[model samples]
Target: MNNLFDLHLQIGSRRARQHIQDTPLWQLKQFTRKKKVPDLSSLEKFERSRKRFERKDRLLAIASLSRFAKLDIGREKRKGLPEVILAEGKLATDVAKITQAMLKRTGRAVVSRLTGSQVKAVRSIIGKEAKIEYFSRSRMMVVKSHSYTPRQSGGRVGILTAGTSDIPVAEEAEVIAREMGCETRSFFDVGVAGIHRLFEPVRDLLKWEADVILVVAGREGALPTVVAGIVDVPVIGVPTSRSYGFGERGLSALAAMLQSCSLGMAVVNIDGGVGAGAVAALVANRVGEYRTRVA
Candidate 1:
């Protein structure tokens, strides 16, 4: 029979790289010399013993990941996104226990909404050797970068914001998109207060050929509609707070954005940066896949 890995038009199983094993002649020779044992022609029994050892090892690995400290390690394979830990209500000691167990099982852990006190508590429990980061503006703490390197799944998604105050929301979206393995570009501090700046930078953003646009704005919320009118790609609108007086803390912006006149536009909840990034990532991935198929 031809070798499965042969590239010279060899017909083999459906799997090109099937796991094939050669006889363990060297191992048998060493065993015989070291133990004064006789060489055997009983190949069937030797094969059975080797396969038994291999099966035991595989089962052990699976059991290690199945119920390691109440963590579902199999989730890492089933869901493209890693399991996340919320630090909002759990005790620091319990969080540490959970995190360390997860790290042992999966080698990566993310805890969101990490406060100063909780950060201190987690550090104390982890004994100061753990690597964790605090995203100050987002009020989140992340154990950045998992064990396996994540691939870039989506093409570039252009990010835009109405004003400087909207940067926090924009940053949150950027973080989530990057975490989702999508290429991102941002045009910040371009608001309708100076329509000239908005039009010009937005024109530049369009020139870059974005797969999708995440337009984050506060107050009036007219930026997303205007942006959608100009771009052919899908526009995702995220309305934030930081607006004064009648803005009612982004409620007005949310209302305005939802009532947008432009077509092919979608709006997430108020200050829902994660929601916006999830939608953008999906669109960006689809566009990338479609372009690849066409090319």
Candidate 2:
């Protein structure tokens, strides 16, 4: 198998050199001293620096990939979320290999939309290397290294689903939020059809000081608006493809969510549990920071 990281050092070093060459006029003296370059004409020096800078700006690091997939290893540092493999359409073997590579590098990997066969393949490929947790409802898998420990304190996310049909999506959000260093509470089957069911869960979440809430629904998609109206925290709406006919395949639900009257409500794509989870995590993180400052 071709190695993805094989070109990492080579590319990084080359870029670093090019960056030095691009150093501005004021820093050209230091750059020359560092490189031990002999004296050159002022025009030559300026031209060389400009070309170097341009090259450096245009340079792109070689993709980090094994054979079939490119890995974003630095996403966690840059975006607060590691690259998660979406295994819906890929070959099972390819998923295994990519997930294994990620696990080896990060000591943890999340694979969503996994088929049963893909899950088995991943487990077989990464055998004994990590602890795997599978959520059948969500078709998601989480592989965690034994030594990995997250900070004890972080934000809180409340995940609510309109009906049992939406639990799969809600669970996906729950897993992603928890993995992103947020405490999560889940409430299911609380659609607006029966508004009373939402009260207790909402109260509990408020009492627990949840920083953000994720509301998953289908059909009219009114749950998010209701939740948003009640909570001061940010509310992320996830529209699931749970209904057929007028709001068939979640299109209507998505539209309803987008047109919500609630001020703090945000909507994700149909069945976009991951996106909703990510947004909720970011909001919760900010809330946590604010709380820390206040205290």
Candidate 3:
């Protein structure tokens, strides 16, 4: 009986050694090493997840004002231009709400094409939270926090209107450019009808070192082409709906600008004052940034 028991014990020990040899070295060593603390692994995973979430949040940095609107709060950070609210079709209450939310996020709100009711609603809703400036001619409104001051980009923009009727569009561009921190100099009623009226303003803009020029015109829209030919800087053409008879409502103006022969001229859609201004501001700001870096 004792011999049998010894043999059985030897057999069991042999089987255990065989199992150890069959196992991977890493698996065998794991048993001898201290067991990994689950807490550390979990913490590392949590940190990785947190970083991923932060990246996604930054990419989708938008503010939802209920379900009516989602304001692009990250616009200014991503593209040097702030998000502008168009109040043309939206309800006054909605516009006011969006303006409030935008002000809360960026401390500045620009609303374009605001009707009288929309302006009233915004002023009433915003109350003491911000100072609102209404441009009656352009039907636009600018809201700013009391402590906010626009940082100058040291960029200059020159704006010209073909006629008195085009002043509203030019004013809209002026407001947008100025809000973007560019100093704007405007000359009104400088159309090709009085071809000589264009030279003095062009000379003045050149003297002022204007980085970009915006020409707001209607009817034939020949002003931008003329300005582009004379000026070395970039010229953006903004056509307006200020014509009568054949090719009325700025169709002719848009066509004329698109078919311009000038080399340095770019054309925007009919009455696209906001787009023109934003583009002009972008160019001016780039020049300003370059100047800053070199200086």
Off by over 4 Å in 3: 1-57
lDDT of 1 by residue, 1-295 (tens): 2332241123244342122234354554454456554544443454565577666654344323334235555553544455566777876766777766666666566666666777777667655445666677766555533444655775668899998888878877776676667889998888888878887767777787788899999888889998899889999999998687886789999999888899999999888876687678767877777777888
In model 1, the Cα lDDT at residue 74 comes to 58
TM-scores of all models? 0.68, 0.78, 0.81
- Model 1 lDDT vs. the true structure? 0.70
- 2 versus 3: better TM-score goes to: 3
- Output the worst ten-in-a-row residue range by lDDT, candidate 1: 1-10
The candidate with the higher lDDT, 2 or 3, is 3
Clashes by residue pair, model 2: none
**lDDT value for model 3:** 0.86
Candidate with the greatest TM-score versus the true structure: 3
Ranking by TM-score: 3, 2, 1
lDDT to native, each model: 0.70, 0.82, 0.86
Error of 3 at 230 (Å): 0.6
Ranking by lDDT: 3, 2, 1
The residue pairs in collision within model 1 are: none
